[model samples]
Target chain A: MDYVEELKKDFRYIEGLNACINCGVCTAICPAAEVSEYDPRQIVDTVQHADNDEIEMLLKGDTIWYCGECLSCKTRCPRGNTPCYIIQSLRSLSIETGLFIESIQGRKQLALKRTIGEHMLKYGYCVYIDEIDTEMFPEQGPVWEWLRDNREQILTRLGASYRQEKSGALRKIPEESMKALQSIFDVTGATERFKKIEELSEKKAREMKISFNSGKDDYFRHLYEGHND
Target chain B: MRYSRNEVWETYQKEIADNNFYFARSCIRQNVLPAAEDLFLKIIGTDLGKNIYDDARQTTCTGIAYHSGIIPFETTMTVVAHLFALMNEAGYENYACSCVTSFGIYSEVLETWKHFPEKEKEAREALKKATGKTFEIPKNLVHASDLIYKFRKEIANRSKYRLTDTTSGLPLKVVDHIGCHYAKIFPEKGIGGAEFPYVLAGLIDEWGGQQVDYPERRHCCGFGFRQYLLKSNRGYSVANSKKKFESMKPYKPDLIIANCPGCSFFLDRWQYVIAEMENTTYGENGYGIPVLTYEELAGLLLGYDPWDIGLQTHQVAVEPILDKLGINYNPDMKYKGAGNSNTDSPEQPSSIKMF
Candidate 1:
């Protein structure tokens, strides 16, 4: 199937794209559009008029990745379309086709898959406290390092359970619940998606001559760092 | 203006349950600002005498993964359905979400299920297959800020310190950044609608602060999930926040409040980054504007200690605001460890002042 047909196969694309009147309301309100050259209207227009090649180019490019998925586009689209949803469908298709590795932004799927995705299956939280460290996330500031060093004590003072096997803030999610969540992921194709990301990323890492080791390895770090400018 | 303010606000009013909440925590908030959730239960349950239960069995709604495109909609829907089953088991009808993204995810899933019964059946079957659990959707799904907004007046009456500046005797100029997910996805789901959500504004106003309307009042804080999660794309994340901070700078707002955990985290942390990168600060005296969650604001007004509420966790110090409100605290205790132990103070940033 062509990229466009694959996108339309998803319900989000169907609901998010009716007919683009090119009203520019979505772009006008989009935060991503303001900061970067990411025009949601142009994206919709491109998809609407594109042949299979154009669709393929978009899937491999950074345009779809630029959307913050804020869904501000849904609030004002005259045709009741959601450009954010369209971008989502495109992103999913991009990852599924392994075309995401073609762009700088799209390649970060490995970083997300390893961190938020893997963290969900392991820790039951997207942003696990233990995963965060000052060396990796210096932007968390000095206070965060201090908080990290004294987390248990500080959190205990503030009344959070904080890895305790009790029912309260930041309490450790039970083993049974984690098993069920993993089962849901496996059954719902997320496990497959994670595997696909790793497989594609591994292939791309070899092509670039970067090491593909476990955890936050050389390839993962390469995709994660640089290009902030 | 094209729309009437009173009419728009009245039209956008949502029905929030008064009490008995099944609290769903945010991963970011719990990890970063643990005191916000801690004080939320204290204020809602102990202070206001309401029934809000927090079950340890509840897991993430997988909104972050769903947004990042790591997980498909089916997975998120199944996860949310599982959460609803937990709520049902706890015998709670009203769902209060600590995270705006989770609130948006829940809103999206519920709306989708309503539009497509087949998807709902799919989610039902998926949940049953995975966990052997049947679910009942909550009667009322609300962001935790909506509940706080609902009882703003009650909270105001109990506030130890109004948002008025103790020294100036004037309402402190406050900027409230409502998370885009809270209303942008489904405007009808949020209070006061998308263009002008009153969730935080109501809190600021009722507690004696003036809400500032800046050019970027409706702009996103730019968490952007993967955009910020990956270091390389952090420029995009921080740049969006920089836009909002630049626009709000001229307003010289004394405080910035956000309902979303991601928004609050980025807005707070990005100030330090911006200050370091650009060598400029927004708040007075080279300190960045004190960014807060609505829960943290309530904690302050209800006279919770700064350290106890985890204000010390903030990158940009809350001491300036604490002083402005005349809330007394031991400055020496700012970095105190759990057992009255004095810890090493963090090295302050050269650009943005830190406590």
Candidate 2:
């Protein structure tokens, strides 16, 4: 499918992939490299020298998802390269080709899509406080639960105009603005991209003989619960 | 690879607008740290007498989704363009962003537009087709912390207290954690550049605190949007914070100050998680180190009521630092609702001490 060709079409791939000197400066400074098996120098070298079949293997593998997107790598690359940006392009191609499901970390994109992506379109905010379930997030502890329960009263005390008509913290976005945001998503192909993620995730679930109900169902729970070291 | 710090820092200095700002509130900050934004507007507008405005029609920059790989870059660019259009309609040339992620994305998008004019054309056309709103790029793009750094001396002059321990008569040791996105992407866009950013340090320098430089000072707080968003990947997130905490422990800093909302959130909350999971603590006498946003620090220095600035919402007890600084607060009003209404306190954690 000419995966490398499709990746090069993105501007980040062009601007990010300057001549690679294989100096490993980015790897030394990368936070992900410290804790994980991920290495920016190796990823750049693989992409620079790998063949079409080898490139396909990388697109469907787990290495690309290891980047935390901190972009610390961008600041240190002596060759003027940004391995982080190249990783972004690789992730896009992986999702576009539906090869993301082959790896554990890459498959979590569905969970992110359902939570952060859907929330952006529906609530006009990325992380809606009301939607945070304590069971799903035990690390939040009891204080967050208390805060969520007494949200309106506490927000008011802090001078927040929560859910009010206009101005102040957590104010509702107007309907016209929501429509404009929706139109941007539709025009920029994000709406279709979201649909693609769901459809492919469902297909993968069927292949694995798992139940695939929509929105935090059995498959979503499986991916959300699966951890990678 | 060795060079003089002065020669390198001189090239990184960038101009910050003095006043007349159009504020951009963050999605997470409004939910997590609502007072952070409120205090910023109050400090900049009422106290400092600047022309800072917030409009009701503005919305999230969709940066969280964009960075999570759920949405494409074009969608983010179009959404950011809409934000600039709102600022243009409101008659402000300086854009002050509340979220570090949004600030980084804005900087990235603006740089992209400069390098690739065709992409900018596409974004303008897309904005016109969808919202019928036209925008001119902001004359100045600055993060909220940058603005505070610009006026640190003024804030210090008006401060009612210093970051000093009254009992010991010594300056409190402080750790400053700048968001990775703040300067890592483009060093020239930040105050002191990436390796050594002075935005938060400038505040500590002027406000009577010593800035502690640890081994992992530049490490990310590990709120990597994707890593923290997924439940399974959170270990990686917490471990990164643990790395920073371990490195800073030997220095024995009294408090940690973070400029990013997510950094403040994880650094504060994860201390409780670490204590519960590993039976370890970084602060003195079984207490976790108190992490405060830059605005929260400014508000405290100005003698704003503790509850009024939302210190009660933190997982780590702030009383230690407040006591160290000799600031007065009524323990009874810690969890009170609006107009002194009665409220219930959450069951306290067994590990870290809470008020």
Candidate 3:
């Protein structure tokens, strides 16, 4: 894939970078850079030099994945550079080029695709209470278990009409709204992106010998279970 | 408007429409802190006598997916366009978002459209073709907390409870976790400047709490949409949280108030995770610091019932702080519902004690 061409497609990424004197202040303030091997300065370094191979290597590797996108670098850059914006474009380029399929982030896309990506279309929420199981997230404690069991009652008491047709917070999202949401996803090309994520992740899952099924299957569990530190 | 990082806000100034608001509900905030939106509606719509429309017809900003890189910018922009179209159809111009991510995403998308006018055209065509609706860009867009900060003195005057714990009779030591998107990205839009955002701090001071500024004050709450969504990469999320907890542990804050739904959820839940991982606690005793959305705190200050606000659903037990505040709540209310019916007994019930 022509990684530089993909990066060039994003004007925001080009504008985000100012004259980087390479002072390394952004990397110094970056928490991801601190805890992980990700360095914003180096990513910027590769961008300025137009190093295609280095940029390709970045797309296929985890260094680009390591940005938390906190934009702390945006906050402290002496040259007014926006490393986080560059990171965003790189991520987009990675996905567009299918280079994301080669990295850990690429594999993790399936998890996000299923949980957040699908959850929104299905329930109109990114994080729904019913989907969060106590077994997977034991940190919620048994009180959450009780709340899960008594959802309608608790949510009602809190003044939200949970799953109800009436218009209030937590009400069952309207049918047309859901359809419009799906249409937005479709017309805007995000659905295609979601499908690509599914296709690529399925292949990756097969390579790992992890069978993929509908929900929380072997590969899904593996991704949900987490990856190497 | 040259939004320089060097600007210091001596007086708060921005285009915050005072009335006729279109309130956008947050997906996470509703699930985690349902009563927050309820209380916000109560305070603004009823108490303050403002006409705020929180239509159920509006959908999620799809921000979680967008920020996680599953959804691209153009897609999210189209989604934003649709939402704005809905708001425009409803005859509301002022947009107040309940979620920080939603607020930030709206701002970011609008800015992106501003930079790339053709993209805005595409989004408009997409929305108009799909929904048969047209939109005018909002005259004002602000977070719900920004409204609260704008009306802090009014809320202070109307509030039934102060920040002082009723039992201890001491002022609450508060830690405000301002979401990164709120200020870090665009400091000009944020209340005060990014470095010393007084969004939560100003409210805390007005409401009678002592704001504690720790070393890691500006740290993200580790809800890296991408990092945290993938379970294996959560260590990165926790590492950032660990940094904040370690830095704030010295302050021994009584309550944590945050504007961002994700931050509030992450800070509340990760404290428990961190405790289990490292076998240490950050708050008083072995429990963790109680985290509340700024709206939830506003609800509490307005003398809202603990159970009515769904405090029981919180992973980290709020009972400790409630007890410290001498907030009167029947111990049985944590288990039994109104009128006292039998329910299944759960294992390790943190919200309830067998008293």
Candidate 4:
């Protein structure tokens, strides 16, 4: 994929890129700089000079993954530059080039793909990991007991019914929408990736003596706890 | 006199002679049961206590997840009908929510049901066949915020603690981040200056706190479905945070405030996480800004111990600011009933029910 052209399509970021005066102020104030050698100022400098090769290298580097995307630079930049957005654009570009495949974030990437696919398949909603059941782990004791105690109160508060008035009715997804979502998932290789993660996560969970539940809810629950082991 | 769901519910239980009441909940709160139930009990306590029979047939608004594309439209509709059935079961035509999202979902679903009576009928039948009960959205559903703001004066009168800042001799500047579901779902009904809602800000001022005006005050935290998922870029989250932080950075307020848990989580934690990721300084004069939930902040100003309310667990620490204000905070002192009902006070009720 011609990632540069893909990014060029969204020129809003270019406006931000154009505003950079190469001031090291962003770097001086950057938390990532303190924690790691990744420099926002350098990334801005490279992009400003149109050093595509250097930009590509920076994108592929582990340092880019270190960005918390806090936007402090964008908030404080005198030139109104948003290095954070630029870094994201760079990440998308790097992903296209398969450079991201080598990073830890790349491993996490499969989790996203899987989550999107599962949401499309089951809930028609993106399943967040926080919704999963982490009862068995007992990191803080049985999560289910904790949830059980407040379940009624929670449902009443949110006004959600515990059981579907009609359970099976929710299973049916429109053929066309399902296809469209599936195609998107396929294009992104999300389905395959998700399956792999699920298998691997379950395996890891079993090895670690952590209970792993199947289905979208469990997937998201584990994901939320960063327990995709 | 705007009262939070708890304040309203408590008042209802104490004063209202009605037992049949309407109820609603937000999708996000479905996962975080305690917060949701705390608000629910408060609303119930204020409106109709034990006399109010909770209809078991209630369904989810499923708005946030649906809006986020995590849940399908068909599922959302089914959930909507389920809520309607609960209302039918309870035999009440009125409902309320502690969350802006639930309120918006209820309103939207109610309107949709009106527009598509056939579809509504189909859903009703489907639900009836499955649960042996019928459901429908009430003609009058309200966000708890609206109800609370409606009775702002009463709340003020009821307030027990008188807040005074001896050192600054100035009111605390509070920046309000009203939930997006509230502003976007029912613009007109929302209290706190719906369009440019400063109602919460005003309420803060009424509580002896200064409401600070900041740019990007109305922007969504990009926790909106697509934003949180599209982690590769985090473009929306970053942009939204930047706008708010930049707008407020100049004011150098003591704290940034939020109503919703998700928004609070992002605004409060994102700064530290992002700063760590981007290597940037978020604090004023190289110090980080503390983000507090409206409840937490209110509890503080009301003379409630901050530690009791889980203030210590907050990622963006409020210690420096509290210390600067010469207020004593016992990090080890847990709120009397941090996770139990016994902790609920008449002034600051926090119990919530899920079903």
How many clashes in candidate 1?
0
Lowest summed-lDDT stretch of 10 residues in model 2 chain B?
B1-10
The segments of candidate 1 whose C-alpha lies over 4 angstroms from its true place after superposition are: A227-229, B1-7
Model 2 agreement with the true structure over B180-227: per-residue lDDT tens digits: 889999998998899878888878878999888899999999987888
Preferred candidate (DockQ higher): 1 or 2: 1
Candidate 1 residue pairs that clash: none
Sliding window of 10 residues with minimal summed lDDT for model 1 chain B: B1-10
Residue B248's lDDT within candidate 2 is 99
Give the best candidate by DockQ. 1
lDDT of each candidate versus the true structure: 0.88, 0.88, 0.80, 0.50
lDDT for B79 (candidate 4): 57
Question: Model 4 reproduces what portion of true contacts?
Answer: 0.01
DockQ metric, candidate 2? 0.75
Clashes of each: 0, 0, 2, 72
What's the true lDDT of residue B28 in model 1?
90
Candidate 2 local lDDT, residue A138: 83
What digit string (tens of lDDT, one per residue) describes model 1 on residues B26-137?
9899988978887888889998999999899888999988998888999999999999999999999999989999999999999998888899999999999999999998
